[model samples]
Target: MTRCRAWLYTIICFALAGLVTGCWDGVELQRRAVVLMMAIDPAPDHPDWVVVSVQIARPQRAQPPSTGGSGSTSGGNKEDRPIAVVSREGRDVAEALQTIQLAINRVLFFGHLQALVIHEQVARRGLAAVLNPVAQSRVVRRQIWMFVSRERAEQVVNALPVLDVIPGMHFTNLFRNQIILRRQYDATIGGFRQRLVTPGVEPYLLGIDGMDPRLSAPRIVGLAVFADDRLVGWLPGDDYVGWALADSQFPRLDLTIPCPHGHGQFVVNVTRVRSRLRVMNPDAPRPKAVLHVHVHGMIEGGPCVQKEREADIQVLSRQVQQVLAKIIGQSIQKAQHLGTDVFGIGRQVYRMHPSAWHGDAAWRQTFPRLRVIVQVTTRLDYMQTYRQSALLYVDHEG
Candidate 1:
């Protein structure tokens, strides 16, 4: 009898729990505006004020058919845009967002935010103040891609994406695909914050440039070097290419090696690359860092200057290694000149020799003067399809 009474009590509790489990604190999706991309720019007139622009995805509603016999719909077409951009200014990011909320009828939600873009001017000034509110906000996710735009941040945010209906999605896909296909660096807000506060290392953001001035199509160009939290300068063109080779997590790169015969360049499609950095003599006034890079690739296309002999392939490999070492050396020099440790060499030093790290202050002073040595080893394992170039045979007969 006691057991039966206990079971009845449990049943009653379960029924009451179900009654209270409905959407008590839920907002309707249609009534809320979802922010997909956000941009922060310093106000031209007032340096104290910051202009924030947001690209909000508008709800898509089906359009009714045309009244006339024409097949086209009245309200919907391929030309219709699925997003709306709004801008507001305030002393801080939070205040600016609040002002935007007051102007719009719907509540603004950042849970869907995909990208964060800052104008070059704003980035050069500093990101601490701008990123503070965003880092603290529960709605903003840490994984969003961050960029420093050469053009106004608003222009990148407002630019229409050609491939996708939503601009933010396009940007996300573009960055992710580039990392896989081109082996570019991946920079996110979370990674940036950790690097900013962590000792022995600094942070960087991908530099974006407007490809077409009229269309305002933005493209990832290079990297923006930051000393502490302030942007120092840019790593452009081949300069960035060198950095990417050293720092990429998955290094698949392309190299144009000058032919040994001095005719033209051959393309080497590097499928795999690995980099290892070692610190020597940490107690010395100037510590030395040795970076060893191992690369394995195949010759894609070039004038076939080499005979089919194994000796010829070995010689070609040595030439490729020399070129790669020179490129990596140049990249390291550029970072050293900027007085920024983009390679995280200081972090390696801290881990290997903790006694050497006095603190953040001491590491910064030592990093600029430190010596770096780059060594590259390359192997051409196979000559795809062709054993020897047709040109080699033609030249032999001549």
Candidate 2:
């Protein structure tokens, strides 16, 4: 009985201690600040000075002490709260950020940041200075999306969207959708850094600019190509489509194949795409790359020609394959001639033959002289709608 009573007493004492001190690390929501986006641009007066723009979430409008009626709407007043662009002049990015601290009320928090928008002028100068903070911060995740804006980062971030109140949130979702659906190249900061570190692989970032918000259209205007840590050039608009198709990372793509025999056009959305690259060295000859692409897709739309005939399907498939082969081959040639390794062919070669990597010259020296061959094969599956016959007859002459 004495032992049982001592055990009960110990349990009661522990329960009381737990109730007294439960959570010491907890923080009130009002004490914390959230950042939406950040932008870096060049200062006009001082050529080396940097301008920093930070978008912070505003607190909900407080209610009156008596009635307790809130002033904010159910959806939150995201648009009314204009992001304050605080411009500071300093010799370097670190000093600029420190200087801004004096002008702002809350601490500059970066946990919830969506993107880091850098201006065109700044990108040309180089990103090593400004990017130092992001790379060093333990709180900042490496996957944060980065972009080069043609307009001033301030204007790009402040542009109000007609559909969504907060432009930053909308822009983040838009770019993310491009990767989820495989519409454009994957340009995450982490992946980009890896490519930059890897020998012979050039990194690329997409250029983002706002269109007329009334029409709800946002577009990728161009691409910002990088050689290691510096920006080299920009590839304009759909021209990057070829680069994307050539890259093994962006294999699945949508293409509209036009019929040469006046049968109109067919929209083909590739489902599974695989590319095999081989590097052959024949007795001191310059290394040659041969690429083989195998794909399967469904016919989105086209005029039915010999719809049920197996021979016709085979002919059409072969023709489509030929067209794809030509387009892809052209893209590869363009990248090689431009001296860009967007396809990572050099990296493949390094993996295949480690000895060749150490002995051969730099990728740029060999890229201009490298030769490439492309072969493609496409298989078409069942039509989107099954009601139609393989061959359709307009009129039967009996």
Among the numbered candidates, top TM-score falls to 1
C-alpha local distance difference test of each model: 0.76, 0.64
- Per-residue lDDT tens digits of candidate 2, residues 320-356? 7766666666655666666667677778767886667
Error of 2 at 368 (Å): 2.0
Ten-residue stretch with the least lDDT total in model 2: 389-398
**lDDT of the structure predicted as candidate 1:** 0.76
**What are the clashing pairs of model 1?**
none
Give residue 286's error in model 1 in angstroms.
1.8
| TM-score of model number 2 | 0.77
**What is the Å distance of residue 27 in model 1 from its true position?**
1.7
Error of 1 at 163 (Å): 1.9
Query: What tens-digit string does per-residue lDDT give for candidate 1 at 220-309?
Result: 788898998999989887677777777744456678999877888888888887788888886688778888777777877678545546
**Model 2 misplacement above 4 A:** 1-33, 61-79, 82-84, 180-186, 210-212, 215-218, 236-238, 250-252, 282-285, 303-308, 359-361, 384-398
